[model samples]
Target: MKGDPSPKTETHKITGLILAGGQSRRMGQDKAGLIYRSRSLLDRATDLLRHLPVGDIVVLGREDTKYGVRDTEPHLGPARAIRNWLRRQDKPMNLLVIPVDMPELGREQLYELLAHEKGAYFHDLYLPFYVRAAKASAVHASTERMRDLISAFDLTELPVPVHWRTALMNINTPDDLRALEERQLG
Candidate 1:
């Protein structure tokens, strides 16, 4: 979807959502804390999004701001984290959400993805191909005091460039880290 263009505007419209609250299991550590280059993966991901021309940048994490994270409350899965982050916003806006582990993502790739998104209705805007957000307060309303209903949206994948495929890689294992390091060195 990154290659698709919209007729409404040439610049594209969207917000940046950084998913950062995962309890890392496979990596034997918090995936966002993994160091890449000179900064932690969390710092790198947030910085990359900050450089984008999006409306707002929200960090969904579990109280870790030393890396410059704003920290969203009501930590849940990526789905819930995203919704809670969205609810806190002063205004409604489209989002470009991705996990913290995707450290190699480039600004031009993100902009290209935003250019192709379209909304189903006026208030219901479509996000990038990687993920989409919808107003689902009621869907998550039935689970105790928790907003568990606010989960992942219906995803529509976009085909990115072959070299950029690593940009979506979520480092989950030692091998994964090794592979990334090798790629960096090579």
Candidate 2:
């Protein structure tokens, strides 16, 4: 009974973890609140994960929130929040992490990462990733940089898709978000 996963959880193969606790210094506002095709970045990330094989979804940080864990450390980058969530898990489970600012990440793209031996990530962009829960401590100790943490593994590195590279871009600043909205219109 102690080791058994709940029926609901048992049916899920992967757990979706939305990392939304960033300070958004560059964006000049909550990046999660930014609009992307009418939906907020936070809503889009959660919705994309829901279309996957994930058994459950949790968000890290953000107040007045729903379906997530608070960052506890606030803007200490992703390591603090991820580590906090990792230590709370009763058992090792596969985790799919997606940053709230990556508005264009889709189910197909995430699936590509999960298809790897361990997991996969864009050659440079690494927030949206697939990692086993067991590596939480290792990842925490590894580095605060998302790319470094993920690259330490023998995971597949994806090449930038020339056509959709903009879609995968991170909206880190107000200008970045504005540029993307302009691209969408033009």
Candidate 3:
């Protein structure tokens, strides 16, 4: 069910997806379940996204209860997971895809991405994407072979201003999380 669009709406009237199926080799634990400020990393991300201009939020993970999260894995890797999300979505073909490991995302950063780019792409391991869901989904679906799909598609990077770059940082290892936690504490 679609609601009337309003400036007060936190999320766009688009699909909001979180990538959370990583094996977490470096962390040696489920990154999505990590705690920050007393909340699970995924929980914090979900709270942030709730205030965005998005509609539905879907989480793609490897198993239904691996991290005790509401959303489970649809498949492995971002491309495969998103393909599943796109298949399930019945709304407009636009989506805001963020990672589960990014616990520090803020509204200002989200609005900035929405304002400047028709879509957003990440060069790093984990970052949010604002995109035309159909086109992005098509590209993701076409890939079954292990390839550098982002480079293959020639998707352009939506330049995030310097100040907002830190907001996109993702937790790939325990050391990375420790650093981020220190940064947050400091």
Candidate 4:
């Protein structure tokens, strides 16, 4: 039996999670609704997920029942929003989490994360995480900070290539958005 062929591994269902439930205090508005490249950030995020092989896509923050699910408790943070969403899932699945503010993130970066069998994220970046739904309780038990939640799980820290550094930039303020726009134009 040493050379026996092994059974095929079952692929876990993947759910694309867009974390849009931020108060946007720094930008003084809802970051999800901000217009970038003539489309709302939320729309861009959804489109990115749609291009992937995910089974379902969920938006956490807005109240549009069609594709959005409001966080169990609003304005808490990304960690709490993710925890709430994971707890409500009917079954365990793989979650590809992204933030609405990361406009520069492309399919290539996401695909890179998907390449890892165990969950993986950029070395220093906390968002754009690929995690398992079965770890919901672990997330819930962690502190509200995203870094704390990341430490609760065994996730690989992928090295970011030089070309992908811009993709990790998060637009947290009007200045950041303006700088991104300038870079795009120039």
Could you estimate the TM-score for every candidate?
Answer: 0.69, 0.85, 0.74, 0.89
lDDT of 1 by residue, 9-125 (tens): 322345566767777777889887789887988788778866765555656674546433444544445555555555565654556666777677666666665564442211111
Which candidate has the highest lDDT of all? Answer: 4
Model 4 scores worst on lDDT over the 10 consecutive residues at 1-10
Please give the RMSD to the true structure for each candidate, in Å.
6.0, 5.8, 5.4, 5.1
List candidate 1 stretches off by more than 4 Å: 1-13, 66-76, 87-91, 119-156
Which stretches in model 4 have alpha-carbon errors above 4 Å?
A: 1-12, 140-142
Q: After superposition, how far is residue 138 of candidate 1 from its true place, in Å?
A: 8.9
Query: What's model 1's overall lDDT?
Result: 0.57
Q: What is the lDDT of residue 17 in candidate 1?
A: 64
Residue by residue across 43-158, what tens digits does model 4's lDDT show? 89999988776778888887873578878989989887877777776777777899999998988888777776667789889989887544566665556888877777677888
- List per-prediction Cα lDDT, in the order shown: 0.57, 0.74, 0.63, 0.80
Clashing pairs in 2: 59-68
Candidate 4 lDDT at 12 equals 32
Which residue window of length 10 is worst by lDDT in model 1? 119-128
Q: Output the lDDT of residue 39, model 2.
A: 93
Better of 1 and 4 by TM-score: 4
Model 4 residue pairs with clashes: none
